[model samples]
Target: MTIRDFESHAPIVDEETFALITELEVRKAVRLQYFVSLLGIEADVEDGQDESEASRTRERLASAIREEIRSCDTIGLVTTEPKLYILLVNANLGNVPLIIERIAQLVSRHRRPGDGLGELTLSMGAACFPSSARDRSDLFAQVGSLITEARRDNAERHRYRLPPAES
Candidate 1:
């Protein structure tokens, strides 16, 4: 049987490179592989209130996120409304939650000494490539779904609407 089952997910991804990397499980070879991706910007915290200011804040946060992510992670900056960053993890899905927490913390650490507001918060969604989706488009959509879920979740968890979904 062919070991090329890729699932579908969202918000949107440019998974251009195609590969057939072998996947090994605890005691046997697996027929499925997964790539995890983080979608959207954390919206809970912010330093800028206006468009230009918000853009700059987002740029800084995106840059910071890039530095925090590992070298192997595929990081892509999405040019959407709120400005989103994407992290593609190829190792496995088991580490996804940890990765997300690390990202959240990284953003927190980079936040400037309360220019008035305290910590910086962002909204994010994550999806597993080849597991949540088989094609790039589907993966993007799933990530987007997560982003929607995240916005609502963040709104409730943080108290404010996280930045609007990025382009």
Candidate 2:
């Protein structure tokens, strides 16, 4: 089955479509002098599950995120990787942490026992237009850097026997 076959309550767009929408939003933000936040989400399911199971986990996580975001927001799935992108129209950097926390809570609530899904981990990074970046490329680059930082932090926590921070 194609990647798009995965079930999601939220509308999931391809990378190209997402990029176009993001560009439009960025332009609007520039003209209106508002804020736009782009969030990059990466979900990791513990190994041992088959491909189908992994895809299901992703779907569930996406649905949970959808519940936390507004109707104006958008979710994009990268078919080549286990990554999801969220476009928060008019949302600024200050609003990112709260959104992330809500998403995390929703995902946790949706988790089921005996599903063999194991522990699902989400690493998120956010960037806001005009504040975190000057243009689309810079915005994406900033998000990528933040994602890398989040992954590093997760790794450090695991290595040091520290509790994982809520995303």
Candidate 3:
């Protein structure tokens, strides 16, 4: 998929290219010879008081994510909102954690001081074709749901944890 448009600082695939890639995935499903994993990433700024700063941080974070993806992998902003999806060709489910860790490391390593309110957390979810899903639409739906769940989990985990009081 080619990103022909820009949403803020993020590269986004046009609807036509997105559909074409979906069709290609469907066709590839017939052989079941290739392994493709769809990784969904959601990033948001914790402190949204400064809209401009938040936008810049999100852009930097997205750029970092794009840098981490392989040449064979296709990254695109599926929505104008804070979300990205990577179509990793020949990717294995077993190695997903490593990939995500790499992404997180890159994001953190490249982040400017105090970007995203000092905590630019990433929520990741992945689904493999012919394994987690049998078709393009199913793959999209499953990964979408997975990312949403992951985001919810992250939020809950960080929602109400007070630091130690001057121990």
Candidate 4:
């Protein structure tokens, strides 16, 4: 397996490594009095699509996210599912929404015509250290809850054939 440095653009790390880095960041935040934000992003691909198409959509989404994030941020994959984690160093609660909006716009721009794919929806949840949570575990829990809520909201909009939610 290839190893990517921390500064690499959206380098995909495993769960253990991701957790370790997040814990370290939490510690640093305690000492430095800086904020750290964690975002849980999940991509929803259309059903009945082939595995290859879904994989390509995921790759494109990841690329778009990588392009929007800063060099200090980190991305990680915790499972085979389309869920991803982004560690935003020095980002505060006020900034997470802006970052998420930017990512959504970038992903929308990256979509191509005739890709044999339906709309790729992204559900994101964010928690900031020192503001939203006491530590890494709490941060993770909050992010998870937020992601779930976002997904539910998205599904509700789709069920009613309503327009997408505003950023």
Models ranked on TM-score: 4, 2, 3, 1
lDDT of model 4, residue 2? 34
Q: Any runs in candidate 3 off by more than 4 Å, and if so which?
A: 1-12, 49-58, 80-82, 114-118, 155-167
| Candidate 1 least-lDDT 10 residues | 18-27
Model 3 C-alpha RMSD to native: 8.5
| Candidate 3 TM-score, C-alpha based | 0.73
Report the candidate with higher TM-score, 1 versus 4: 4
Model 1 lDDT per residue over 51-163, tens place? 66665566565556665666544444344523554555554345565666776677556656755434555556655455555454555566666666667654443221222
- The digit string of per-residue lDDT tens for model 2 on 1-167 reads 12243343446677787788889989999999999888887777787878788877776677667767776788886664426888888888878878877877776677689766688787777888887678877777777677776777765321111112337
The Cα local distance difference test for each model comes to 0.47, 0.72, 0.62, 0.73
State the TM-score for model 4.
0.81
Which segments of candidate 4 are over 4 A away from where they belong? 1-8, 50-56, 80-82, 155-167
Candidate 3 per-residue lDDT over residues 1-167, each given as its tens digit: 46754444334454457657756865775677877777777666666447666655555565666656665566665444325677777775766778887877786566677443566677677777766677787777777667666666654421211111232
Q: Which candidate number would show the highest TM-score if scored against the true structure?
A: 4
Better of 2 and 3 by lDDT: 2
Candidate order by decreasing lDDT: 4, 2, 3, 1
Query: Model 2: how far is 95 from its true place, Å?
Result: 0.5
As a whole number from 0 to 100, the lDDT of residue 69 in candidate 2 is 77
Residue 129 alpha-carbon offset, candidate 3, angstroms: 0.5
